[model samples]
Target: MGRTILLKMLLFFGIVFAFCTCGKRPVADLPTFHVDVKQRDSASCFFSGYSYVMLETNMECLLTDVDKIKVDSEKIAVLDRERILFYEHDTGRFIGKIDRLGKGHNEYLSIDDFIVRDSLVYVLSAMQHAILVYDVYGHPIKEIQLDAFYKHFDFWDEHRVFLSSDFGNDTYYNFVLFDLRTGTVLRRFDEFSQNESVFFNSFSSFSGRNNKELYVIHPFDYTIYTLTDTVFVPYCRFDFNTEETFDMGKSFAELSDQTRNKSVVKYLGNLIESDSVMYLTFDLFDSHGIGTYLYKRCGQQSYLIRINEDFISDFPYLSSPKGIHGNTLISVLSASTILDIEETYGLSFFRKKGLNKEDNHVIFFHKLE
Candidate 1:
């Protein structure tokens, strides 16, 4: 009986030891790949430009240009001056004007940003601090008013919307999520402060395949946040202030320091997501010139893609760019040019002409090559 009892005790100890050893094993590191491709220019595309100026009380809201217009499939619907124009994506034929608000209404309802999902159009009106929902036929459905000042917004899913507020004197601005059907505040996240400095810029969010995980980007500091279990969590943080990481050499750092003052970093782009990858864009300016970086998030680490100066020099009006068809990058070229290009797998450029002569030139980049 004593021998049998001792054997049982030894077996229990063995099982516990095995469990602890397996549990303590570290997880395998994520894999990474680097691609070296020579830059090449492709085709040209065009888009229309609108100009407007609003006077309210003693303040003036001037819209120097309406750029970065996107198409739902092949149809172009964007505001030009005081008129909202629609065109056939293939033939570039003028379809009709969508919105014809009076000067008073236009001044108050000027579109700050817009997003298209299915048959619904979501436009952000910064002056009103509200979002106007409209159908494809240009009919208003409903509106959502946010308590804080918002700069841009994006749809998380069919029922949820994410809004980004402008960073005031504070280093970071708050991001809020709202329910579209009920217009209820669902969740909010604050920026992580660095040395009492909160990094503020437009934020980017994309969900995984099963929507099990959500990814967010802080454009100012090159930080990436992931939302898990309905809570915002820091997945990885990158410091672009060093050489080993930034790789711009001395010129890049000097330029970053100089432009750090007059240059304002804005998140005027869209987040592109695939089954396994995500991409985002952010603009950085230094005294030398302005530069835009395309940041890619694979599994854990992030990769940087720098926009060449030659491309920017050729197309000066290209600012904030977004994704179309989940793999292409679309942006406005000059005041009148529209650019469409593939951003995933590889990079390519395409351009089209806008409606009028002032809006006739468009340029875009793709990854067809």
Candidate 2:
């Protein structure tokens, strides 16, 4: 009886050890949940509007087109044309711009995307085909030259950078996992879809809540993946419930100017999720408008925020709610749109800031309730 009990204990221990050492499961093995989004023309306000500060502009900080926006511990970093426009954390006072547009070793010609990590700014320059790092106070730190041209990228960790390339000689993977320390290709996954439209629509392609957890969504693929320790596990699959979802992987480059304009109506954009809420947007297939959707996880409820009623009337016109920062849902309103809003609504917020409606922009931050 003692020998039989000993054998059973060893078998149980072995089974437990095997499961613990398995690491990340395959995408096929992980379960995928479907978020039910109710289609609507308008809904109630999800977040309450708090105070907002316009970005101050000067010779060194002349704001042009904002490519991306990130909120750090001490400042707000805005990726303008070829430089990073920094603003004070608590107040929207302009600090300075990092780097510049030049052919020099440290300067970048074209800034594609940027992120703040460990109090350092990593800027990706597609023209230069390199990423330059700068300290918070506008000092050069390091630079890494990529193997190929990439349009957008975000830091996977301190050592690895996840890059998205639309054009390359090889057509195997959609994203390249790059090592920053050695400047070599670590790994690549996400098979490329032979469609040109996927390249043009690639913006806000990668996002995450933290270093350990990051997610990427391909517009042509329409599936979300969570990068685990070992594998890219399938997280959420969206069901548009129609055959016409996403132009059927059609390349927008092949379409005529009229067809391209018509196709923008219903193109799917990015999918961003927080601890409880998920946000996604799509253009109208029939009309010239953009619709934003929100899915509440606790109640499994969905809402299509009315742009005119909930957002535009109170705040200026927004491109889209990009991501959640701290306890707020953040969005960008361009200077041109803010000027139009001021003229149409007779608002004095722009006047009080002494900002030219065509030069500088304002960020709308609403506290999540």
Candidate 3:
């Protein structure tokens, strides 16, 4: 009986020791890839743009200055100025528009940002500190008022929303979780660290969204983090060699004011992750160059995707790119760019049902191989 008790005590102690050791294990280092723009330009996978027809109505609305875009399985959404226009994904048919911009009750004075999730559209209004919910047909469902004003926001789930602002200071948190139903602050993470040089030109925060994870990159710091429950854990690191990477010691505002182009670093833009690869697009201001990178996880290899033709030449980089269903990137093209594509490459691939020069726009779809 004494030998049996001794054996059980030894087993219990061994289990406790193993659990303590496992809890103290350090985080593994994230993978880094060095992208050489000049070498990648020659060896790249090229993709061309094809035009899609837009169904016209008596509204006579033209999407001139589009700001943001979001995609789902069946529909594509574009935030054109103050309106959120929905289009059929298979065909670029104008399905509906959400343009309830007013100062009255349940009406928004200005729209800050929007997201389409689960057949519902959530529009954030900074002016009124409210979120207006709508259906796919542009019908009003409900509105939720937030206590604080946020410049940028995205819906995380049915009841939670992630919010951010450029005007954040030491007192203001960089990102926060707000309850959608009651407009109450649930949790806050990451402090705002931008100094005075952030006023000349501002860029949106770098964020990527998949079905299961939400990733965000710090502006001043080059660290990418993923949201896990209530905290953001570091996910990956971007290395641009010794000379090309941004100086983390100085603020971006300071770098912009002091240096012309010599000390300025490459700006990180939109990032999206797939099953086997990660897609990121950035630009170089000193040399006026834009590059899209794909990092494959199988062999841990990264490559720069150079669109050979002037597919998106009108914009500096892929502006407001959204990862649609089937792991594809989709964006809306202006009417002028559609004409340019038609002139350069013949219209055999395009279906010009009711598309005209100044009235209709094209939908650009890019599939990864």
Candidate 4:
């Protein structure tokens, strides 16, 4: 009887061990879809015959063109509209604008960065050389003076703001963290050097995903940097020296000798998050021309989407291709003339058709496939 009991106990323990060793099955990953929106109008607020708009819930607002006016949602606020506008979801009003107080175009208002809360909007105005806080109704609430031209401002949390500036040279640009509630500078970093002369003509901080990081891009080098409390680190850098399979146009070469070397890193764009993946559009230019490259960041790998020039040349005057709030891709395309390339597949044929308004002017959104 004892021996039989012992054998049964050993068998039960062995079965339990086997079950514990078998771990949970790994979750399957899904394939990412690529979507593009083609704009119908060729001339708008966006510099390259394009416009910037955002879709939220059931409403959309067109920021660039004055003609195609859409209903602005109450949930999103139109913060600023000097050259490039910014919208915040929480405030539901324009946060920053050019101070029209006794100023002309010579003293135009330029907002490089902003942070909005329930009651006030904190703005870093580059041309103004100060931080301006405004109420929801575009009224000035307060101001913080600074010695440098503040280029970009980001929020670390509800109370802290990060600011970046250029000192009229490539190497002197600095980043500072300010306490918004107290109007005090908490930290600053001035050791980093920027290659503004070679690659980036200008730099601005993109909206960060979390409070821990701030992302900035240099257009000329196609490089991106991230700043934290401790240091300014290089995050992702794209070198545009790759062999080109096709050429759209020599847009970069058309700039004057002084501006020819500069490249655009960030225009008005956004980061789209789906499932566990993040999608970002890096608007870049090379000797070939201006184009948008889609990048995907998975758990460990970061790579560019396998899109060809044929896909780009098919739509001339295409501005920033932005991701919608939903799972769609939207962009504004403008041209002196719009063309119909829906039937064309090759790059050479699409360029030959040129711009024909009947085919080109429209805002395009494609469901990611």
Candidate 5:
């Protein structure tokens, strides 16, 4: 290895050794919330009503789908594949888009995730091992290259951000606290487990955006950890009320294909958190059962919301949401579906000017009472 690479490896091991005391809690020690998946309710049973904002779809700002969404007080950013499309928060007025999908110094091949910290937009291009920073408009500021491979990331603080790969499939560190300005490794979590293999990597491990806290979860592990200044501490656990159990301590690579295909898998996760509740969407690797549950942040009271009953029936892709405006949660649907909804429910809505459902997507903002 090169001298610089060798030095980084040593630094990583040293950091892991130093922070060993921020230990993982025993499974029995974590607090658990019980969810009754069978007792399901339609979206209307929980939400009083919803309002929508149709994204302006002219020739300039056309998007196929919303891969991910980040909503702030005044702006909304949508990752439509490799491009980041921006829109007004109140009205879906088209803002400019950031399309730097080239093999140049300021370009990236793919965008795994993106976040608006303040005035700047930080786009994560995992395959390029770089995060291209830009102003609110699509103008390029600079690129921060990285040594480690991280598919998803969220800010831990101003100076540091948390980067994580798969839960147990990575050959080296699964999680790292990385410095944004200097590109230094502040800390590394659980280094060198099994061989490198990608498994269940599509899930968004980080949530708790409203509170500015980091809450992360994996598909196989039941525990959720809150990131502190030092290490991750157990925050809560999902008690699915099943009597069956498996080895939560081992890496996913240690398990066979049957175990992986048969086990529980969390899709597009995030464990969406508001001030009062944490929303979880999960499945058992089969079509027979897929459920969503809302658990209280301070208490154990929970309710299961049934998908396929309404609103395109997407568990997390309504579509790929992080738009926390208030008590309101957001989802996406085809604009043409509105006609179907009105006809099926025998209800009428005030249709907008350009309400063509041929290829347009509408944003639904709903509040749970």
Candidate 6:
């Protein structure tokens, strides 16, 4: 009996170990999730099941805007105006908050972005040129000073980070691989050659999925790249081949604001990935409106499903997904937007969820088909 019990315990631990390492593959070891740019407006698979996480709206956790969100297995961290709020991911229960939003050395004036790793949170303050680290429960750890111009960053590994700079100006290198512990840059890329005519993107999104996977898009270049432990490699390329794509023979000097707005498909980012599928959003010219697509990872073209929400589609209303959990694509929409849809289409989503228009936003977990 003792030998039989010992064998069973070893088997149980082996299963647990396999579950933990399943999603932790070094990125280069993983197969590529393929997508074609011309299929931007193609037919999509109908995603069937979803759930709403109504963020607990109390006096301490009233959210004005959800600028950014990071989710792990248990906790969800949201970056609001000046504070980073925490919530229970499965139940949407409000927990504590990190509100060191003052001028003191320990506090940050603003939160440009935030990254959550293990139980630690790294809040980036662009204006202050520093990153304040804290525990998940709002306790201060330490602050890491930054080199003044990194607009956005995501952890490439435990000791290294991938940093991005502003577009348009001929100032800093477009991207850098920096050593956080050694205070050194190991590599620099895309040094701007043009000095005069400027083109810039106001925001840069360094999309990270569970710290094991990191992806970024070039400001004007239509290629999306993935970062492994050592290098950034091309993951997918967009060739819209339409008149609206910016690089189709248009010179930088001849473009105006109106033309730039119409060419959004050219400057696409917000690239979110999961283990089985990849998702992103892009705008079409004029009345074409916004779009979301779920490109399956197995290299079959037919698996691409355009996540469309007409007034009566069974799928819940969705925008760009902020992150991914397991195989589900996670997105958040304001309760107000749902109230508007309710008001216009005579739907009862808000009423069913016990949500008021002014309540906190709702998070959607879309389990892909």
Q: Tell me each candidate's RMSD, in Å, in order.
A: 10.8, 5.9, 6.0, 14.5, 7.8, 12.2
Summed over model 3, clashes come to 1
Over 4 Å off in model 5, which ranges? 1-26, 42-45, 167-171, 199-201, 209-212, 241-263, 272-278, 283-300, 310-327, 350-354
Candidates 1 and 4, the one with greater TM-score: 1
- What is candidate 4's CA lDDT for residue 265? 39
Report the lDDT tens digits of candidate 1 across residue range 143-251: 7776655666666777887776533313244567878778777887666342222233223333122245455554333344555325555544333332122223233
lDDT of 3 by residue, 281-330 (tens): 55444344433344333346656644432344422223334334344555
The candidate scoring highest on TM-score is: 5
Better of 2 and 4 by lDDT: 2
Error of 4 at 28 (Å): 32
In candidate 6, how many Å is residue 2 off?
76
Which scores better on TM-score, 2 or 6? 2
The whole-model C-alpha lDDT of candidate 5 against the native structure comes to: 0.66
Report how far residue 306 has shifted in candidate 6, in Å: 6.5
Sort order, TM-score high to low: 5, 3, 2, 6, 1, 4
What shift in Å separates residue 320 of candidate 3 from its native position after superposition? 7.9
- Per-residue lDDT value at 230 in model 1: 53
TM-score of each: 0.56, 0.75, 0.75, 0.52, 0.79, 0.73
Clash pairs detected, candidate 5: 317-320, 318-332
Report every candidate's CA lDDT: 0.48, 0.63, 0.61, 0.46, 0.66, 0.66
Per-residue accuracy of model 6 over 184-264 as CA lDDT, tens digit each: 778876565543234343246464444455767664556666665555555666544444644343444544353555635
The count of residue-pair clashes in candidate 4 stands at 21
The residue-level lDDT of candidate 2 at 255 comes to 38
Instruction: Tell me how many clashing residue pairs each candidate has.
Output: 28, 4, 1, 21, 2, 3
Off by over 4 Å in 2: 1-38, 41-45, 136-138, 166-171, 193-198, 209-212, 241-259, 263-270, 289-298, 306-319, 322-327, 334-343, 346-359
Could you give candidate 5's per-residue lDDT for residues 58-144 as a string of tens digits?
876776766767778777778776888888878889888898898987888888888987878999877887888998778999989
Model 1 TM-score, all chains together? 0.56
